[model samples]
Target: MPSIMQRLNLRPIVLAPMAGGPGTPELAAAVSHAGGLGSLGAAYLTPAQILEAGAAVRRLTRGPFAVNLFAPQPSVQPTELEVEQATAELAPFHSDLGLPPPALTTQADIDFGAQLDAVLELRPAVLSFTFGRLTARQMEALRERGILVIGTATGLEEARQLEADGVDATVVQGGAAGGHRGGWLEDELADTLALTRAAAGSVRTPLIAAGGLMTAGDVRAVLEAGASLAQCGTAFLRATEAGTSAPYRAALAAAKAGDTVLTRAFSGRTARGLRNAVTEGIGQPLPYPFQNALTRPMRAAGAAAGRADVLSLWAGEGVAQGQEGSAAQILDGLWP
Candidate 1:
């Protein structure tokens, strides 16, 4: 049988599955139709929504696309004091937005098992996960169905771990990649080329390099460095088919490449993005789900009201290099 990459029929360009909003079904299908693998950032979606999204993508293109989800994370059992502090920290943002005081909920995290069940049923061509690796049983299920598994890694140790766990491929996410950092092993900050070279040397699994990849030349350099393919997120934030908010798109356009800063202010996990008031204001947040949920309403209001300061405008170090075009056009220009 042909390899998974061969089955993908790709153009060495894979969409980076920009969760939160930018990775829309329209964008995914457009990239797939253009001969590159497209991905749905389904981490935040419920099981029903995941199925609906899969159906929507199927309707748009017969080509295969990947569905991405966050691996199951340890539920943060925050102390009452921690919850109080988090709510207090977000209260000002809520007040400014004319919203109710931020409240802590028992159900802040997505149910990964339920989400996995949904993915099994949806059964896209590929399944990619980040933040951690799946269990043996979970990996077995995906393999049994012939769904290629791609796990994210930020360094060599994690890459080896993913291979040991039986992933079909590994996404070597450089520190400069946008959005949440996927490094579970000691907050990896290696450069993309360095990490890719290290993993390519150490692991037998195919490597996908992600981070600050904006042009065909950038992709080529990574490929030469031994990456099998290049995955890009920041480059596609402005694609016409993307669901990026107006304020977020504006921020990306206005940003210099150096404007992005790493902060856990919005999501309670370290992620690189455009610096704003919220990130600067909130220091030492609760954990992932708690912080992500607490700030959701404020972030939603910010996006609605066109306030970039209150929103999480995730981007990479290549902010200045992002292009404005349709997804197809972007893919063509990136790899053609």
Candidate 2:
């Protein structure tokens, strides 16, 4: 089966899926309505939530869209030793927030197999993954259901592996991309511009360049570098209909918000975000899920309290390039 890239007849632009509610059904549908592919970040949702989000997008438009999830990695539970290491680092933040030292049990147990089953049942037009590659069985199952599988890659070696693993295409993520990177190959993350073009140089699979992409010029450059399409995440965070919280929106708009910073304090894995204080308290971060879970309460409380400093505020270095508007308006700039 041809990949969704071939099937959709879409414009050479796609709104990349970002986890943590930023890529909502409304945002996805809006971008789809604007003639680019829309997507849902199902990594943080339950199977039912994924189904609901997918169904909502379907109701909004028949234009092809994408469903994205993180390939399940071994739950890296924080060792008591490691937890002590990170927690001590965060003691000051705890004091500032007027809270007790975070307990170690803070973790989420998302059922990955169930989520995959739900994804197959929903049968989205495109199935994409990040953080790591998908298993052969998982790829085959999605293919059998007529879903196009797209793997995320950080460099040329990963792109090569995705093709060898039988994925239909690759979302070539660069260092500039916000949220978790797809670099599984150690020391292989070359510069986004050079790596994305190089990854596509030898692969027959279509390439989708993602990262630090905001303006029409950036879009044109990626296409010129040989990407068949450009996938942008931070560009949509400021869209009016996006699920971005007010603090996140403001952070993106902040004059001081310069290039994105890479920190794992929020989720235990490195992700780019607008530089902020929460990331500054990174020394005490537990491992994935644990650090993510430990800080969940604080981030929620802080966001509800309108505290921008405590939020993850993920975005790329080109944050200064963000503009407040609708998806269509942003697409006008991206595709012009």
Candidate 3:
């Protein structure tokens, strides 16, 4: 079988999917057209939206691209007491943002099976997932349809597991990675360089290094250490094509290397973003989709008002390296 890079004919760069907003069809196509594997972070999109986004990318680029989703995990519905506590905690922020109280009745209906079916129908060059792994049947189905399956990992064990489970490639997400940490089985954090080196030594499958990689040197180091490609998210946040909101883009531009922290305040899941009032105040959040849903209104308001403090300003530790330009320009600068 061809290697993942060979199959996609991609360069040593992959656009890490930034779900929620930053990942857009135009951004994906621009990067793919520039020879890297651009990815759609379809984790937050409905099945119909996923198909539409794939079509939109197809219309822009004939080059190979990938669509990423969060593997379906069992939903954790907050109890009344839990909901009350979370609501009370967020009430002040809601008031500050001039938003109404969150409706706890709204459940996160993320149908992974339906999303997968849509992906099969769209037939993008690659199908990648994080948060968790897919079942054997799902993997077989993807393989039968000729879709390359890529899994995300944060440690050697996870990489080994993905390889054993028959993933075509594994993105070794280091501690510096922005957004959610893909360490589903373990909580211990490992730096990107260390994790990539360790996973490369252990797993035969191609390793794609992710996390604080922001420059050509960063990409070269990972490739030398054995990564087949470098997957970058924060490095492209300032790219003109990214759908990053105005405030989030400003935060990325002004952010220093250590301004980000991994907090569950915004989404219940441990995701890294800029340190702000919301992150500093909240301690124990409800749970993944529940916490994510609870804070949606405030985040939306923050975005609309360009309030950086209340928004989930997701970015990696290498955010300082982010530059403003078209996606193609950013890719050229990173590789050149």
Candidate 4:
């Protein structure tokens, strides 16, 4: 059997699926065309949108690419009081954005099964997931289709679990990683090198090191530590093809390495982003999806008006290393 890297024909560089708005088909394809594996962060996308994104990437490159989705978590039904409190906290921000009062409803996340069906149909070179693990049946289905499955882990235990669940590879997301942390257990954090070494030592699956990796030296360090590839997200945010909002791009340009914090204010899930007013004031909001929905209008308005304070400026600890250029240019700089 071919080694995982040999099978994928990867260039020791993998583009992290940034999800939400920053990840775009054009950006994914551009990176893949450059000999790295491009990935679409499809966690927030509907099934139809996932297919459309795959089509978009196909139009741009025939190289192997990956699509990532969030593993399903049990629904957390917030108390009416919880919803009201979250709404009240966000109401002022909504008003400041010239939007209506926050009115939230019971919304469902995109069906994971449906999303998997679409992914299987599109048959991207790889399918990766975070936040949780896939069941034996899910893994079996993917394997039967000859699709490689990758899972994200933040610690050794999670890495072992993914190996047991039959993931072909795993991404060890370090604390310096931007956006959502990948550990599904409690919030135990470690830097990229530590987690990568730990996972590589503990799991049989090939490891992909992620988080805070900005330069070719950083990539080399992780590979030397036993990672088969390095996946980068924040470093690629400024890529011209990325769907990063103008305000986000500006924030990245202005941010220093330590200017970010991990907070649940934006989406009720702990994610790293540049320190802004929203991350400062908002006390604990509702859980994910709910908090994410409650703040949607404010975020949308913030993006429209180019206001950094109201948008979810998801970035890794390596923001200072990001530069404005095409995805291919950014990849060359990171790998060369």
Candidate 5:
């Protein structure tokens, strides 16, 4: 049997699987080249794109690389009310871009089955999921193939659930993390959870702390609290090799001295990002892919025009703590 360390090569530091732009082939290869396990955030890619990136990484580095996906967020009703309310929330950007209102026909369109089939076919070294839990049959299929599975949990109950689902490890995403809060429980679903305590008290699977972790001390603090590793996404966002846009990299650096907030204006899921007009003034939109799609054109236009206000700009509450440097240098800081 492969030991846990042998399975993941037990890299104490892990590269965060950032979707959209940051998870480029160069970034993944560089992290793997640096001896840290790299992760390609294949969540947004079509199956073909995911396979292409994985094959490219294989050509560049002979090391462990994880493939991450947003484990199919729950579908929301695709109704006139949902669409009108959601698209109306996007009007400011539509006006700014001088374009007709987007005529969105459907709301939810995430193809989880296709993505899973891609995972099964590609068979990357590790497979990790976010957003929510996996079905028993899905978990069993991956296990049968010797694929190591990691689950994200935002709270105690979620962590326990991950353990029950047979995940080899659980990413203890702190409440302060960027992107989405994958907490499964109600009433207790605060926007976020603190990392250290969440790691120590809940699920026994090896814990990898996420959110607001910007420095080596931060990684150590989580490990001391019982985590086995630390996954730092925001810390690497501005790194030289990261796939973040010029505007985003610049904005992230500029926002480094400012505050971050959790808002659903970007993608319907509450993601932490810099404080901006779009986030603050907006009403709730269509959920998940609908909200994501509704804002896609705007996000594209904003980035093209260097307008940070309309872009997703997803980061943890610790945006102020983000460092500007190379991925290897960032890894050294986190690991050393």
Candidate 6:
């Protein structure tokens, strides 16, 4: 089989899949149409939603694109005491937003098996995952269908493991990356360039560098460091076709240096984003899915009402460099 790079026939840029509303089919298709490998973040989407989204992207462009999901994690639930404490902490924020007390355990996890089945049916050019590696059987199924698989890594060890697991490519997500930190291994997070170089030297897999990549220079630097492609998220947050809300777009435009910080307040996972009331207020979040569910109502309300304070404004360290434009324009700017 030809490699993922050959199958994609892509430019040097890959669009980082911005889940939780920012990543739209139109945005993904637009980037793909512009010669970059666009991505739809399908972590929270139901199987039907994923199929509909994949069809929507197909309607927009014939270019190759990727659909991404968070690898399945073992089921865990917050204790009743943890839920009560978290709810109590979130009470004021809810009241301020004219909402009821946060329902800490109301949200249920998406069924990953169904999600995978939907992806196999959609048969996109690429399937990528983060948080953890896929089971060997899952990997074999993707390979059987001629679908390329990519896994996320935050350090050399993760990259090595992803290669060993038979991923077609590994996205080396450094510390400067936006959204959820995808590294599940114990190794420390390295900068994009450093990790890319280290992984390039250690593994045979093709590398896609992600993190703090705002301009063409950043993309070029990562490629020079041994990445075959550079993936960008924050740089496209303001892309015209993205589903990023009005308040979020405003927050991105107004963000200053040091405004973005890694916080677990929103999703219980350590993710990079702009500092706001939620980040400043929450002491400790329960954990992924639990914290993610606990804040869903507030975030949805904040998004609906154009309030930036309560929403998860996930961004990277390069928030200052994000510019407004079409997805094509954004990709053009990032491609050297």
Candidate 5 ranges with C-alpha deviation above 4 Å: 187-195
Query: What lDDT tens digits, residue by residue, belong to model 3 across residues 168-260?
Result: 999999888899998688856788888888888898998899999998999999988889889999988988899999888878888987899
TM-score of each: 0.98, 0.95, 0.97, 0.98, 0.93, 0.97
How much lDDT does each candidate structure score? 0.90, 0.82, 0.89, 0.89, 0.78, 0.89
Colliding pairs, model 3: none
- lDDT per residue (tens digit) for residues 11-120 in model 1: 88889998899999999999999888999999999999999999999999998999999998776678989888988988999999999999976478788999999999
lDDT string, candidate 4, 134-226, tens digits: 989999888888899999988888898899898989999999999998878875779899888877777779999999999999999999998
Output the TM-score of candidate 4. 0.98
Give candidate 2's total backbone clashes.
Answer: 3
239: Cα error in model 4, Å: 0.3
Cα lDDT tens digits, model 6, 1-336, are 226667785687889998898999999999999888989999999999999999999999999999999997765687888888888889999999999878865756878889999999999999999999999999999989888999999988888889899999999998888899998877375788888888889998999999999998898898898888888999999999999999999999999988988898998888999999999999868878889888999998888888999999999999998999999988888884
Off by over 4 Å in 2: 1-3, 187-189, 255-259
lDDT, residue 131, model 4 = 91
The alpha-carbon lDDT assigned to residue 177 of candidate 3 equals: 87
- Expressed as tens digits, the lDDT of each residue in 178-232 for candidate 5 is 7777665642433323544655665568877787888888878877777777777
- Highest lDDT: which candidate? 1
- Candidate 2's residue-wise lDDT over 85-187, tens digit each? 8777766667777778766663466677888899999998888887677788988899899988888888778888889988877988888787887777773
TM-score, model 5 to reference: 0.93
Model 4: per-residue Cα lDDT at residue 320: 91
Give Cα distance to truth, residue 286, candidate 4, Å.
0.2
